[model samples]
Target chain A: MTTSVSPVRGSRDASARSGLLASRRFVSVLGWSCLVSMALLVWLGLSVAPTDAVQKDAQRLMYVHVPAAWLAYLAFGVTAACSALYLWPRTRSLHYDRLAGASAEIGVLFTALTLALGSIWGRPVWGTWWTWDARLVTTAILFFLYLGYLALRRVPDDPQVRARRSAIAALVAVVDVPIVHFSVSWWRTLHQEGTVFGEDRDAQLDATMAWILLWAVVTFTLVYLFLVLRRYDLAGIEEAADERQLERAIVERRSEAASSVVAAPEPVSVAVGAAPGSAP
Target chain B: MTDAAYVIGGWGLTAGAIGVYALLLQRRLRRAVRSLPPEERPPWA
Candidate 1:
């Protein structure tokens, strides 16, 4: 009768199992697509594209540089959104905190790549590897801000307390992103204005170069998506393990208390029986 | 360095960083999965 009312497996657990399988399938497919697209993108950018009139073969760096920049911006944007969701009382979930952290990790990696690629491209063009240009400085600051956000996440504290503090920090750091984006136009800086925005971009880049750049952006975005999914899964597993450890500690403490209570009962009975015999 | 060297260096570093990170993530993920009980393991694991 009890077996009829209760199934061998929980409905919630079964649903979670199915969901995990579906997402795994999706991530694998996306990972393969990203790999194949990147292979084609590398060949197209490195071998087939025409040399720039000014930058020469060094111009090929643009393929990776532009895409890295875009992905960094995108990753931080997602972080900010997830952070916002985490802070809102009605909508808050630990998953939002995990998502924000995962995105920030990827964001930091891409931001580093942006700086490195920019330095490489600049060395051949601007004749120096580093500069105090508005855009460059702002971008460097933005990188450190997110880097600090990652560091802040490491401070040991209560889970809810840590998540709240990190979410606030994330929101504050994201303000630097807009500043980084507009630093070129807002101030007379060494970095050129965006090649593809607010200007005659079509005339600026050859059609083939533009197509290849778009492909690179799309391919890298897929790579970003894949990495975040796996990273978030890792975060979830770690959190679950932490919870299990806490529960086990509580269980062990409770059992110790129960054993101590049972050991005290014999002494109490002897004392009571001795008092009654003495009174008689 | 020549322009070709600069080009190769840039692409090489990007690919190398990405490949290393992917491997590390995969390794950590496998360890995390292995630590879990069979009933609690994720579907992908």
Candidate 2:
């Protein structure tokens, strides 16, 4: 029995193509906005903002370091949410799994940057490059948790198995986030207490610095989204390739089986022809 | 060098490191996408 399945697959491909086209404009707009915002942030932070009286030029690290840490937390939160969605069978979606993977990767990068930059800032003020203070230690733990999450995804052979396990890891890692945040409050630490604007300003920051920070946050967020979307798209392509590979293998096996069946009848035909031919 | 210079250098190096890392990631993503077979090209691509 010949079962035709090609049309269904073709239609699925067509739908995916149309969906991509529909989202293209949105992605481009967000990407450009991110680029523009990053430029503005660099200009304002490096040029327009005044040098600090206390930390002096080292204060400049705030522009990058603070934002990097914030983005790391944001990315991890998204990872946890996506992982949860993936774990629940009713809400399970490859999109969510791909998003969790992308977020974990990006979050790890930012977390590392936060530590590096924090150390740079700390060296000048704290008279040392490294410390095992509460905030610092908790941040390190948070970073490793996500690193483990990324590694877990790489270990499993089956996609569904990877997704489920990674999702659980993502969820468990989220507990570290709140710990990282409250570490300064909970314990005496070398890291300064959280500030509203400038190292504990309850009111507002200088208008220019505030603007720069706002733009920086916006730009980084857009950049994060772009990265995640690109990564997710790559995952989808990989899945399609895997499916195609399987289909090709099946087709090849079936063709081989048919050839064997055809060959079996060929010997009988040869015997009949030989018997019927007197010359033979 | 003055203290101001040291501070600037530190922040500058930090920024440079992060920027380079970002570029590396973008490159990796591009390579990954390019390595895919034509039939497996992402719908977005």
Candidate 3:
């Protein structure tokens, strides 16, 4: 009679299993809400809101450009936070490393979108698609820095080594974000100085337009959160799959070893039987 | 179409793009999860 061991019921790291599920649910809800809110906000901005007297219809680009820039900043901040968590000796966690990698990928996407949309807006309003102004140059540099961070994550095969190196790169790259923000104020740039969330009273627009801009900001923020969460969940899934593959390989090797041990005596007996005139 | 029409068109296009992208992301996530082994599937599924 053979006794079989039941496959370790619910003992295989339940916490990680549950956490992944929760993350998946959270991402789903966030993503759907973002879609609905963005749709409504766009409708309000384009059809119901009043246009600017100075820029006229072209000002509509604000709906897309501002949101893209805002999301880019938010995504980079997330990457920095995750990277710090990954690097801390007492708190070095693979979860944080995965989060950092995922957020950096999304950050690059939003940053590219920001630059492209900004260019589109600038062409119509500034009469040029490209500028050498302080704000524009700083922002472009920030975008490239995150791109470098993403590329770093792909270079190494060892997960722990890759995480450590990428964390260092992310920490160094975050310094550019602040520099980008202060560039417009520190230098004479064709780009307008900070106005929307700053203390520049004269640069402020009318109250209604401000409200519309606020809605746009909120909508874009929701969308960023949604995308980041989704990306993080996907990363978690991939990590889990890799772990399982490793576990399966280990089990297979052990089983092979046990079978070889059990069959060792049979080969010895066959060799002894064929030694002299035993077969004849 | 008036100036308002242009504004509406622009906003509509932006919204549509975002919506499509989000949907595509959802589909990708689902496919990835499905590709995982039954035991390894994320707990939420």
Best by DockQ: 1
**TM-score of candidate 1 chain A against the true chain A:** 0.85
The local distance difference test score of each candidate is 0.82, 0.71, 0.72
The DockQ scores of all candidates, in the order shown, are: 0.60, 0.32, 0.40
Cα deviation at A147, candidate 1, in Å, is 1.2
Clashes of each: 0, 1, 1
Q: What shift in Å separates residue A231 of candidate 2 from its native position after superposition?
A: 1.9
Per-residue lDDT of A1-280 in model 1, one digit per residue for the tens?
0011122121223223212212677878887987898899889989988999888999999999989999999999999998998898866766677789989999999999999999988988898999999988988998999999999999988667888899999999999999999888899988888876555544567889988899999989989988888788787676666666676788999999999998998987888777654755
The order by descending DockQ is: 1, 3, 2
Which of the predicted structures, 2 or 3, would earn the higher DockQ when compared with the native? 3
Q: What is the TM-score of chain A in candidate 2?
A: 0.81
DockQ (C-alpha) of model 1?
Answer: 0.60
**Clash pairs, model 1 backbone:** none
Better model by lDDT: candidate 2 vs candidate 3: 3
lDDT of 2 by residue, A125-150 (tens): 78887888999989999988888888
Error of 3 at A49 (Å): 2.1
**In lDDT terms, which candidate is top?**
1
